[model samples]
Target: MDKLTIIKIIHTVIWVFFNVVLFYLLYSVLINKIDKWVWICIGLILMEGLVLLLFKRMCPITVIARKYSDSTKDNFDIFLPNWLAKHNKLIYTTFFVPILILLIYRLISG
Candidate 1:
């Protein structure tokens, strides 16, 4: 594997890892797991979203990957399915937003 391929693999691994943590934290929030840890996770998620939003919703690794290759194929930097790669944010946000809202309610009420 070349440097670009190695970087792509690292990017894919990090992306998947973050997603797993996000889902786990979101699940914890849904199950009424209220505490500093939940809030910390929420903060991390929001911060990450803000950073991505600043970059037009593209991961920094995606920008770097473009410099290495001109492939327009889906899953260029990740090992995800084409559909999942395309709709991952929409899919996760579907659950995350509401759970976040509930988290806020819990925080405010307590």
Candidate 2:
């Protein structure tokens, strides 16, 4: 009901969505032959674990969420800017960067 609660909910939702998307993309690229439902479940579990690790490791999103949650306290209208909204870009890139490099290396070697 309060602003902070609303902001926290929104932040959590966004983070969860981003995690799911990232996992789905990576799974599709690396495990395209797998069953969709099984991959989905695996991705969900992996993402949840990654989120918890991020939170424990002081990841930027977790840090921002903590700060916003603390600052808003009881506010609900917290709006994140584009940069913050794209905060997980680095994480996603980490998943793809090596793949890209490997592809490039194969092409060059061949």
lDDT per residue (tens digit) for residues 1-110 in model 1: 88678877887788777677677777776677777777677787778789889889987778887887887876777777878778877877786888778778877876
> Which residue pairs in model 1 clash with each other?
none
Alpha carbon RMSD to native, model 2? 11.1
Question: 37 in model 2: Cα distance from truth in Å?
Answer: 15
Best by TM-score: 1
- Taking all chains together, each candidate's TM-score versus the true structure is 0.82, 0.38
On lDDT, the leading prediction is 1
Q: Which residue pairs show collisions in model 2?
A: 3-74, 3-75, 3-76, 4-74, 4-75
User: Could you give candidate 2's per-residue lDDT for residues 1-110 as a string of tens digits?
Assistant: 76556656776676667567656655544544334653464556467558767677434444555644544322222344545444444655576566445434544665
